[model samples]
Target: MGALSDVRVVDLTQVLAGPYCTMLLADMGADVVKVERPGGDLIRSSPPHLDDPEAEPYGGYFQSVNRGKRSIELDLGADDDRETFLELVETADVVVENYRVGTMESFDLAYETLAERNPELIYASIRGFGDPRTGETDRQGQPSFDIIAQALGGVMEITGAEDGPPMKVGPGIGDLFTATLNCIGILGALHHRERTGEGQYVDTAMYDSMLSMTERAIYLQSYQGSPPTRCGNAHPTLFPYNAFAVADGYVVVSAFGTNHWRALCDGIDRPDLADAYPRPADRLEHREEIHAELTEWMATHTTDDVVDRLEGSVPVAPVQDTDAIFGDPHVHEREMLYEVDQPGAGETVDIAGSAIKMSKTNPKPRGRAPLLDEHREELLAELAAQHEAISEK
Candidate 1:
């Protein structure tokens, strides 16, 4: 069994961050019961769906993060459904939600209410800003998404070509990072509960997570008295740590360290470079010259040629697209990709596997994402059985 096999989580989240957080817990064998509204999660109807009639009702967006969780429909606005959720909370170790600051209060199911019902319940929230209980802000209850967080978090400020407009990152780092932190918070709270037999609120804000992630930029600005700006793929503090275009494609080189720089010079058959720019600061001062020299040399070789020449000597990697990642032997051997049979689809699809590897109790997705309210009957029966057993006791 997984480490968290005995833990139960009531997942009252939709879309990305919250669901992804609970998915991490579920992967570790938490019994995550997703409490959906009457119509189900907004992402259930998201795009990139299969053409087959027998395919899973939802699309890739929903399937990717919601895997290994049980789903049950509940209209929290209704008194009966609210009471049902309370009953579920009393039996759960954790309850996670990502909604506006006051949304839960509207249903009279806020953390305060749930904590009263079950004093040992771990309640976590993933909000755009943060809940008022932990910290208050004027931006509380303001709607936000990945892009908004990216822009506000200073990520966009330092993310593009030096002279170009600010750009959003390729992936949803705003949501994903916040989710990971929130999961960490939940785990910490769980540990605290284990020690004290008490549960407390755990809160994570996307904006806050973004600010935390851009720590390097913050420190640079403070130390230099100048805010760092975008310089394409180059790092501000290191030289020869940028992507360059080869004949076939792009390859990133990270030969900023003294030994690695020497190795790079040797790999390129240019011992003079190491002698002329002995120190990393010297190389940084002559960044344009170094970039141009590398660019000229790179144009003569293919990505493979560059990688082959510098593979073991210097930190180098050819920029790989998703297709390359899918076919990579190292990726397969590491089990970074997982294939699961879609619930209703006759075909199997690949999803990203967990990165948390363990010697014992290795965590993995228990199964496919559930169909809407698919486990309603089974879950309600379980709850009813628990209630009956408690009454008997």
Candidate 2:
């Protein structure tokens, strides 16, 4: 048994955000039945598919995020399939979707409708702006991609190089972050339901999540009466908190205050520069000069050298990329990465593992993403049985 062993999720989400959230649920031992359209998710044909259409529809993009979930293909737009979905929803413990705000209502699968039949169902939604509740729906519209969310929600304006135009982070920060927040809300709602014997709605909008992610800047703008600026690798307020160049690699160092700065200077055998950072206002004024001095000190040192010298003196780490992430020794010790064998895709690539590590019921991805709706026949058979029984009743 895993953490969510008893959970059954009807996943009607596609692309990334909602799917990623369902993937987490699937990994934690929830029975996630992913319902895709007949032609399949837009991702199946997105890129990196089997040479023949008959073989597999699992695009590498889909494979990466959809792992551990079962798939069932249904043309939801068609008349016959609506009953199948409604049946699934009636029995489902949770129903999740990220369709456009009205799409589910258009399909008659909205929480208001489903909860009439499934009072205990935890109806969760992920959207671009927000549900009709938190505002921003009518004025701004229901559709927003990750970049759009980041742009409107306050990330794009403050991200990227100081000299460069505002840029999206390399990762799909808005999408993934929204998924994470949605997952949290789902868990919270589940907990509330479990305790009160009542199910409630959970909603997460990319806009709201992105705004929360940028709340500091929001605070700065509203209360401090100043807007945020692009700080490159450095933090908005923390001192000496940027990545620095090293001999063979780069390391990040953060000395938050005078005491840590003093310790860092002494550790480097250069007490002369201790608190040379001066007060916060002064250091903020002389940031370039201070950065230059620290860069000069670390210019000849390797990443490991700086780590060794500054181990306890300050917060420091090497600037590690993806490949480096897999190779890191700590990654091995913590078992933070997982590997699986693909039949012919060669060796299984190291992928990030479940952050939820339970002692009693630890769960993992059961299999690679299904080759399109490989389990369609099996899933439809079950739904078919339910359908016949409902008709007989």
Candidate 3:
């Protein structure tokens, strides 16, 4: 059993951010019941599926993030379904969702309504802007995805090559980061409830999350009176903290401190470079010359050779692809890849494992993502049992 084994979560989230947060809760041993609409989540049909879509239920996009949760379909628009949902909430420790503002209100299932049903319920929401219960904004009703948040929240402003256009990050940081923050808020609310026997609302916005992530740029702009722009693979302030092209592949080197810089110089057999650029400022001042010299040397050596020479002396790593990551012994040792049965895929496939590690009650995914409404009968039985137990009381 995990640390949160006793907690039950009513997950009314669809698509990426909301489902991802509930997935984390499930990993920590929460009994997460995913309350889907009649047709199910929008991303269930996202491509790259096996030959049999019906047996598989969903593609990799849905499977990757929605693991370890029970699914039940309910049409919130219907009165009977709404009553059933409220009953589920009455027994839940948490209620999480990621919908546009006023969505729950339309179904008459707002946070206020749910809190009335279960006073100790932690109501958490991940929105593009935020719910009005916390704060209202002009963009409250606007639907947004990862790219919109990245562009509006300053992540795109400082990404990409210096001369190139602003770019979205390779991964969906907007959704993922927002979801993680919302999870933290939910955990905090749970703690508060444990202390005071009172639950509260937790709100996280994707735009806000992206802005918080790009805090470095904000501080730099405040101090220098100008916003920093993209610098390709280089750090704006730190010299030799960038990716360099080796003969076979690219390797990143971080020689920020004086000792590491000296070690890098010695490892590369260029002690004179260390003598000339002894201080951090000196290295920053002559970064172009230093980069050119390092690049010239790296052009002759393979990524492995560079790593071998600087492994213990300086912070260095090859720019790894998925192939390298899959084959890495360290990754396997850390249990960062979790394998699960992929319905129609003929064999088990791997999803990312949980990063949270504890000495006792370690968190991990309980099982694969559920087929749509797979747990409907099971969940209904559970609700019936609860009703009987309450009647006896």
Candidates in order, TM-scores: namely 0.99, 0.90, 0.98
Ranking by lDDT: 1, 3, 2
Q: Pick the candidate with the highest lDDT.
A: 1
Show where candidate 3 strays beyond 4 Å.
51-55
- List the candidate 2 regions with Cα displacement exceeding 4 Å: 47-57, 133-136, 275-282, 341-347, 381-393
Worst 10-residue lDDT window for candidate 2 reads 49-58
Q: Candidate 1 — which pairs collide?
A: none
Give the lowest summed-lDDT range of ten residues in model 1.
Answer: 339-348
**lDDT of all predictions:** 0.93, 0.81, 0.92
lDDT of 3 at 363: 90
Q: How many steric clashes does model 2 contain?
A: 0
lDDT of 3 at 284: 93
RMSD of 1: 0.9
Q: What's model 2's overall lDDT?
A: 0.81
Residue-level lDDT tens digits of model 2 in 296-343: 989988888889988876888888888888888888777677765443
Across residues 1-393, which tens digit of lDDT does each residue of candidate 1 receive?
Answer: 998999999999999999999999999999999999988999998978888888877988888899999999999988888888998999999999999999999988888899999999999999999889987889999999999999999999999999999999999999999999999999999999999999999999999999999999899989999989899999998999999998899999999999999999999999999999999999999999988998999989998889989999899998999999999999999888988777677888888999998889999978889899899899889989998999999
